[model samples]
Target: MELRFIEINNLVLHEYTEKIRFQKLITKIEEEGVQKSPIIVTKIDNYYLVLDGAHRYTCLKALKYKYILCQIINSEEYYIDTWQHTISKDDYANHIQILLKNERFSKLDSEKDKDILQINTMNDENTPEPLESYIQFVDCLNKCNSFKRVHKNEYSKDSVKVIYPEVDEELIKLLVNKNRRIPAGISKVNLKCGRILGVSIPLQILNENTFHDIYIDKIMNNIRKYEETIYLYEGMIL
Candidate 1:
């Protein structure tokens, strides 16, 4: 409950696990300064352990800020609910590769061979080759109503193909829905890959009820519509 400024170096991270930070986010903080939200930390064994806001911590550290605004709380006083990603980093990389393989894009041989894929724009003078084509490809995947439905094991399915110019607003809405149905997190999608892909909402952000009240209201209302038979059947009754 007590909000105070703490030195960046004094903060300790979770020893067993860590979260990824976004360079763009760090850059934003540097340009605009840290926003109003205070990072949450708890005092344990004379050290402050970051309960949430790892990215913010990293960003502030990168900016070489001597102090950061934070909320100090007792660990026992707060309950933590952690969410793990269903898709691992390697799985996501493989998915991207599989999607690229099915496309008409050309692969350029780089010095490091960093799995860089390029799109051939020899025919269209106006079309951007690499980055633009990459964005187009990702946008195409996002438009597929079945993309989200596909299981992780099916990423390599031969039929998996990227379609273009068809944007499914409804599918996008479902994919990004803040309701409990879809997990919220910071997305790893970036310009390096030519688009945004995943969501990685921090636990602190998720704790804010107001941040998702509207979506939760809609979800709860939808469930109440079937409240009469919601638990009547276990499996497919028809």
Candidate 2:
């Protein structure tokens, strides 16, 4: 594997499915003055498609860097896959804010003056009426059948379990069946417990199609049971 510094304009992003909402990440990168991970890419039809590290790519792009460090790979030899949080810590409070501002909450009709939900004051026991309604709204979002591929991540033994909202199952099925790529930013939500954030469409790619059923089932089961740990490929192989 050769590490190369390629011009940003030369790379093509195909089937990328993660969002680039990394304000904190960008700040960290600026502070550190270096990127920790080199993006992985494969050349297809003379265009380099990013196989991983789209977030890092966006960060560098936002930083106005002309060239990026990358690990170029032979597409035929290695399979590319992705595992991402449907909802990250940064999205938790934002989702709550969306629910609060949405007009669907009838209970909040009288509180028209209030736009933001004060999450710090609410908990399972002493949650305010408006906040409780927001929690139910988030629950409804998760229970929708339209979302097929969802997963939960419990970071540690004592961490709270977070559930993602429902995503368009048919859309995912179509993408996989057609052997196409999934795009970034499906849907994002937060857990009712206020402990974990949800990511609606955490995508995966495989070199061989043989692992589809096994992995798909794993994601579905994780959504059903809110699994604590999720397995995905993460490494900087030389």
Candidate 3:
């Protein structure tokens, strides 16, 4: 539950970012003039690897902010899951033809294969790197007619589902260490407790010039303001 403003350069991403979403976030944050929540991270050795809010981290970096607020969680306090991507039938039909013969993936031939594109089977030196292959796969889907992430598939006639493998902290650290990243919006991290949200911190005070005094003052003020604001909610977050 520790929250503090750390230098942006000290933060590292575990996944590749989507450029279109990154650009949109930059515009949205500029218009709002306040960040709704701090990006979540876990300390790993010398770097704080981002667990969530990849786009937010990149947006602040793009805006030339030297330090960004982060919600620091213990590395062992969270688990990771994978998002299931769905694409239009038309796009799937078109791409499946190309993928069926692709070397990097295997066709979903059995019921045990999980009914999704098997994209993690790079076996030899000649094969494209795992990160590069994943980026290419998602980029093609992005250019398609329709794409979305779904929690449950409706078994619709027009939708094609793609389930990817879930990642763990070990693999995440390996990727960061090698300067590689998976496609964004796939690694879903579930934390043990409630996250700090809706703080609405002003963007103007996050600059380098104000990092020493004004930033700390505002953070303390916000902490005092929300010290007694906690409440219990029993409902599901979906």
Candidate 4:
């Protein structure tokens, strides 16, 4: 994996971030003075499209950091998946009611399962832009009593599950090209061999204008220092 610092402006975010989460990250980075992990990105034409860590990217940019560390990966090596959303029963009903009033959304006939609902855009004038639809959905979702993104649909009488159509890389790139973004916590990127974490590069180092070579040396040293601790694991990590 390639890890290096690049200009923050060189990156593009494909997902809308949570304001609260972004603030929290800024606070954490300020207190710690180190970036715990590099944001993941894939080069698309002339720009680097963020595949993960949208919150981190925005937080650092908000902090006025000119350079941010990133992990560059191949665009063809990853697949995108959508999260299954669950919310409290009352909130779910309220959300559905809200969608019905908005012409942008169309509620499809659900599966045999009563607790699960399928929702999508109607392709009409009322339909907001691709990014806005996700933003609206997230706004409505956050107002719910209890909302969670799940991998498996666990039937719960107190909660209801909602599913949207899967999105592919082409769609993601298209959204980015159009200056749009999917909402946070919905699009999931599955990368082979997982991601590198806990590198803890200090913020000061990132700000140095002449630290590229030194940064590479430090990274090589870090690789040696952590070699014993790194191991490959198959299956899901909770």
Candidate 5:
């Protein structure tokens, strides 16, 4: 029952403890520095196993992060219960999303620290895009980044129409919600397509059908218009 701080690649993971708060960790790494905290693992003769902090190992590897600090314990006697939790990537990401927004973690203020361990809270104008918008597109980016797939399969209903490779499905829904089809002289109903897309299209020259359809080209165009968005493009499973 000795506590020894150690750092090693995943030689052994308790066969559990997979879903770790990844976004927060990555943000802390990206903001404060990569070596914020070490993980705790169990070590035997030649290989070390994980008792806790499996997410740390998996995420770092996924991000191609080379090194991490870990605490290597020397026995199985310490764990009263084997790490019996099972979590998927989606679950882990969702959990991390919550942690990233948590008040406790949000108040860390790493900017003042010389060592800069973690940016638990940051007020940057550009941060992660809303989960609702980015989730679907994240899938596509992850695939593209992994060189797995360049585009996505079309939805059954929209088979004839091309679904833009990088357009987030949820974002489309959001835009649809924001743009109402209110017919009248009311100001609220004037949420035009050109304005939402941040482009200029003269109303006089444009026909009535122009703003009615939400197409993939328009989505791609909007993304290009907001080229400086911070997290709208993090790669995922699409």
Candidate 6:
């Protein structure tokens, strides 16, 4: 129960028994970036133990993070076994612009206004939902498989020029990486921890033109789904 600044790399961990998957984490990693949660300490002595954070440790190891926040505790006294543990997912993202672009927000007098101002105004009957459009984009991106050009699925999404052209390959990959590939059954839920923007991006531009509703809807849906899922699945759902 003590808070100590231990060298994250120094801690020794028990065999990672928890089934931590990468696709499950890709959503938060992309939106929140990295540094989502503190490492779990399961086996601790005068120096170290395996508490949690098996997946996070792996991610840091893969990303080569030099330092991390680890739980400092004793393994002998409170020797309890659990399937999964919950952690924070608040990503301290400095570049909020990536999440909240200038067009995503607007100043109505003084207070900031989110909620896109109806991207599709003219349609008397069939204007697509903004959230739905964002979802479609996520679907399309999943089809691309991150633009790595794999065999068997070599076709490109050039037809989606209106919403997502070839230039937005990276953004598409990010969306798919976040939501589409998540697997179930997790014990700990960690929120992304990093700098965050003061406000959300203005997204009226997505509504300003013809098919912007679909574009904005898809992106927002991914972000919303990501945040909600992170909040809900931090402990048991995985």
Give per-residue CA lDDT, model 4, range 58-94, as digits (tens): 9888888888888899966788888887777678787
Between prediction 2 and prediction 5, the one with superior TM-score is 2
Error of 1 at 43 (Å): 0.3
Give me candidate 4's TM-score against the actual structure: 0.73
Q: Give the range of the ten consecutive residues with the poorest summed lDDT in model 3.
A: 115-124
Q: Specify the poorest-scoring 10-residue window by lDDT in model 4.
A: 122-131
lDDT of 5 by residue, 1-238 (tens): 1222233443444222213456666665446434433455554445565444555565555555434444445432342221111223343344333444543223233233232212222223254544332333223223221111112221222111111212222333342344311111101111111112222222221123334233324434454334453343445658
Q: What are the per-model numbers of colliding residue pairs?
A: 11, 8, 0, 0, 9, 49
Candidate 1 per-residue lDDT, tens place, 80-118, comes to 432222233343355444554544444344224233222
Q: Comparing 3 and 6 by TM-score, which wins?
A: 3
- Every model's TM-score: 0.36, 0.38, 0.68, 0.73, 0.29, 0.31
Give residue 5's error in model 1 in angstroms: 0.9
Tens digits of lDDT, candidate 6, 1-238:
3333345566543333324475456445446554543455533224354345566665555555455444444434333321221111111122111322324322222112322111111111233332333443333333332222122222222211111221122222333334332112212223233212121222222113444345335433544222442332437663
Choose the strongest candidate by lDDT: 4
Q: Which residue pairs clash within candidate 5?
A: 38-69, 39-70, 39-71, 138-236, 139-236, 139-237, 139-238, 140-238, 142-236
**After superposing candidate 1, which stretches have Cα over 4 Å from the reference?**
15-21, 87-238
Task: Give candidate 5 misplaced runs (Cα > 4 Å).
Answer: 1-7, 16-20, 82-238
Q: For candidate 6, report its TM-score.
A: 0.31
Q: Quote the lDDT for 20 in model 1.
A: 36
